[model samples]
Target: MGPLLDDARARGRTVVALSEYGITRVSRPVDINRALRRAGLLEVHTQDGMEYLDPGASRAFAVADHQLAHVYVRRAEDLAATRAALDGLPGLAELLDDEGKKAHGLDHPRAGELVAVAEPDAWFTYYYWLHDDRAPDFARLVDIHRKPGYDPAELFLDPVDPYVRVKAATALARKKLGMRYRMAVVPLDPSPVRGSHGRLPDRDEDGPVLICSRPDTVPGRVAATDVKSLLLRLAGLDGS
Candidate 1:
């Protein structure tokens, strides 16, 4: 693989390297939605064998993933009470306000009004209900749809169920990136591994091909594109 990449670079092809996020060993898991529910800011219900939050009645709630959680408040009038409830909660580092949102490049419509950053030693969990039994079967079966946020646990292959190799591939294909990107779920044939999720398929596969809108931004290659864009945007010189 290294030799192939080197040959590509020698041929004047560019490359870029990036990751979705970093991982760490968490000492404990913090369920922010549980805290909100206990404070009477959020509501949970089990209907149709599924446990989910009642978004209409909730004042504030968090959609959590590994180390980050996006908290959405239903009413602006209840923001103060919601903050008071969430204040000093365990595993919560800081809540991002408007300034903090802008500092973190998260001041966008899709982002939540308040973002929760977890402590380095603690990770966020998407468990809203206290009892696991009351939750849906998918909750324990490595599902991505029932949970509001991302779940890295779905990367693993279930030993009991060999058919569903890529657990989260179905959900990620439907809900992630709003279908802007293509997803490929491949099985590890002749290998010890079961399957992999969210990967680009091999060139031989058939279907609509995924094309990059900006082909200039290549991997394994470093350029001033990011820095220049940031500087120009900050200086009000970039149109966007």
Candidate 2:
């Protein structure tokens, strides 16, 4: 890294690096979904010992992962009830309304009407029901497809290492190969663009599968390079 930086400096190229917001130690984990359920704003459908959101019956529901939650009200009439229910909650640090969203540039069509943020001492989880057995199938695994929310826990190694654990287990099952493999985590930016929330684009713009090829065969595959080139090709922008 030092040598590369030095070479870049010699070549008269400027390099800048920045980081996202920092994190602090968390003491408690808040389940915004559970809160909404308790408030009678969210409804669940149970089938075969699993639970899923009953969007038809729900007045409001929360999609939470990490410290942030986006609360959506199915009907406009339930907005006040949702706000009043979450107000003065212990772990909640802030609840951003329409005014706050406008101030924060989060009032876009894709943005939720209400955003619930947890305190630094607490983080948010996606659990809507209390019982572990009742959790949705996606909750028990590293399934990103079924869960319609963000999951900051996927970035860490603790509690669950979705990528590594799955790969290791797969490798152990096929040990006859006696080979090592790598994994590349390509992040498809899910940040909502105005008027594009919850709706798929007419064509592949920037959204694609979360994976490319297996690590061993990635050297000359479609996504051989970094994530940027891979994503570009996936979007049919790079003229693959």
Candidate 3:
């Protein structure tokens, strides 16, 4: 179990598991406009205008890749602690290739190569890509589910039901929120959202999916150049 799970169990409180993206985002909202400075548990650094992870604070998350994802504790002080962790996290660059090689038994060579350019360990938990190491491992998911105050029923989503579809959508929503894809608990009991692929005539599927939350989360797919500009300029990439 993670630190948060242990803490929740020790305190005899139900872990507010993030069963979907919406629940996780609300629990750890991502303020896109805010640049990460200091992470509560991790020491983040920048050199030559490039951000890097302080290996001291991050534990190599086990996945197909060795340095697949990072495991860090969420701070009780601020929800933005996660945001700070996300923004300051090291992007996949070869700066630490030698150090990364020290780890064995991961598909990092193959999978890492694909994602190391755009996102490294930082994007592992956020998006479904090469580094999504924390995703369900049938072997280990039970310990995670059986923890105190956890409801195992949240694991499965019924495809035909809209309520379950919303739970499934939670995965995407959580990614947009930039929280490590963990467990979530929906506030209401089965108030499902539509799982319709029905596209709006005006909104092309190629366009960025626009989700209106408190700050209106937007995830659009554009050219690499456009993505870079948005991350670097609009999102304060240098600062992060």
Instruction: Highest TM-score: give the candidate number.
Output: 2
How high is the CA lDDT of each candidate model? Answer: 0.62, 0.62, 0.30
Give me the runs in candidate 1 sitting further than 4 Å from their true place.
48-50, 155-240
Worst 10 residues of 2 by lDDT: 190-199
Report, for all candidates in order, the number of backbone clashes: 7, 0, 13
Q: Cα lDDT for residue 70, model 3?
A: 26
Candidate 2 residue lDDT tens string, 59-167: 9888775667788898789899999888877778889999987875568796677987777566666667767658665664456776656655445433233575676
Error of 3 at 172 (Å): 23
Candidate 1: how large is its RMSD? 11.5
Which model is ahead, 2 or 3, in terms of TM-score? 2
TM-score of 3: 0.17
Tens digit per residue, CA lDDT, model 3, 1-240: 688667866876433221111111111111111122232333334544433344354322111122133222233343344433444434332212324434422234332211121121111211111222322232122233322112222344543445645654776688789966633332212123212111111344423332322123234433333444544543345674
Q: Please give the ranking of all candidate structures by TM-score, highest first, separated by commas.
A: 2, 1, 3
Report the C-alpha displacement of residue 24, candidate 3, in angstroms: 18
**Residue 184 in model 1: lDDT:** 26
Clashes counted in candidate 1 amount to: 7
lDDT of 2: 0.62
